[model samples]
Target: MSFFSEFREFAVKGNVVDLAVGVIIGGAFGKIVDSLVGDVIMPVIGKIVGGLDFSDYFIPLAGQTATTLAEAKKAGAVLAYGSFLSVLLNFIILAFVIFLMIKQINRLKRETPAPAPSAPPPTPEDVVLLREIRDALKR
Candidate 1:
C-alpha cells in the first residue's frame, strides 16, 4: 500500500534476490578472470611472442614517442590494443567456462523417461476353465 512497503516487497522477491546474488558472484568471477588474463595467461603469451607485455602494446596516435602504454597515454591519445586483447582473452575464457557449466547443467537436467506401464498378466488357463465349470454348475 505504501511506497516503502512496495519497494520492500519488490526488493525481497525471489527473482530479484537471485539476480542480485548472481551479479555479485559475476563481478567476483570477472575479477578472477581478469587476474588470470593479466597475471598468468598474458604473461605466458607475451613470453611466447618475444617477452613483450600485451598491456604495453599500444600505438601512439598523437605522435608521442613513448615506449610504455602508460607513458604514451600520459603524453597523448594512444590506441591501447594490448589492454583490449587481454580483456578479450578474459571474456573468451569466462564465456567458455560458463558455456561448459551450462552444457553440463543441461545434460544433468535431461531426465530419462520412466518405462511405459505394462498390461497385467493374462489369467491362467486353469483359472479360466474352473470359472467356466463353476458358471455351468450354477446355471
Candidate 2:
C-alpha cells in the first residue's frame, strides 16, 4: 500500500480516533479544572485562611525582601512554595473527581442485568432408546 493510504488507515482507526477525541476533551477539562481551582475553590480557601493568596506565598532566596511573589521574583531569585501548594490542591481535586466518576461507572456496570443462560441441546435418540430399554427391564 502507498504511504498515504497506510497513514489514513492508521489515523482513521477507532482507537486512534477515540484517543484524539479524548485528548481534545481532556485539554478542555483541564482548563475547567484550572478555573475552578484558581477562581472559585482557592478564593474560598484563602478567605477561610485570612485572605492570604497561596500563589503569593514564597521565600526570597537571593532577592530583596518583598511582600508579594511577583515583587519578590522581580527583585531576585525566590522559592515559590505557595504556587506549588496551589498546584497540589488542583491535582487532589482532579484525582477525587476522577475517582468519583470511575466509582459511578462501576456502579452502573453492576446494575446492568446479565444475559440469560441458553437452553441445552436435545439428548441423542440412542440415549433416549437406552433409557427406555432400562425402564422396561426395571418394570
Candidate 3:
C-alpha cells in the first residue's frame, strides 16, 4: 500500500490510540501532582521545616537575588538545584502513591486461590450391580 495509508493504519491501531490517551492523562496527572506539591503540600512542609521556602531554597551561581522562583525567572537568574528538589518531592510522593496502589492490587490478587477441578460423578447403581453379576457369571 501507499506510505500515507500505512501510517494511517498504524495510527488507528488500538495500542497506539491507548498510548496516546495514556500520555494525555499522564500529562494532566503530572500537572495536578506538580500543583499539589507547589501549592498545598510544600507549604505545609515549609511550615514544618521552620518556614523553609522550597522555591527560594535555590543557590545562585552568580549570587543574584531574585527572592522567589518567579522573580528569579523574571530577573533572568541562574537557577540552581532547588527547583529539582521541589519536583523531586512531588515525584517521590507520586511514586509512593503508585507503589501503594500496586501493593493493594497485588494483595487482592493473592486473596483467592484458584479452585481445583471437581471429581467425576459416581457410577450408577444398576450399572455397578450388572458388572458384579457379570463377573459372578464368568467365574
List the lowest-lDDT window of 10 residues for candidate 3. Answer: 71-80
**Candidate 1 TM-score versus the reference:** 0.81
What tens-digit string does per-residue lDDT give for candidate 1 at 55-121?
9889999999999999999999999999999989999999999999999988887866678999999
lDDT of 3: 0.85
Per-residue lDDT of model 2, residues 26-104, tens digit only: 8898888888998999889999999988888898998567999889999899999989988888899889998999999
Q: Quote each prediction's TM-score.
A: 0.81, 0.81, 0.70
TM-score of 2: 0.81
Off by over 4 Å in 3: 70-79, 111-115, 120-139
Question: How do the candidates rank by lDDT, highest first?
Answer: 1, 2, 3
Clashing pairs in 1: none
Which has the better lDDT: candidate 1, or candidate 2? 1
Candidate 1 residue spans exceeding 4 A from truth: 112-139
Candidate 3: the clashing residue pairs are: none
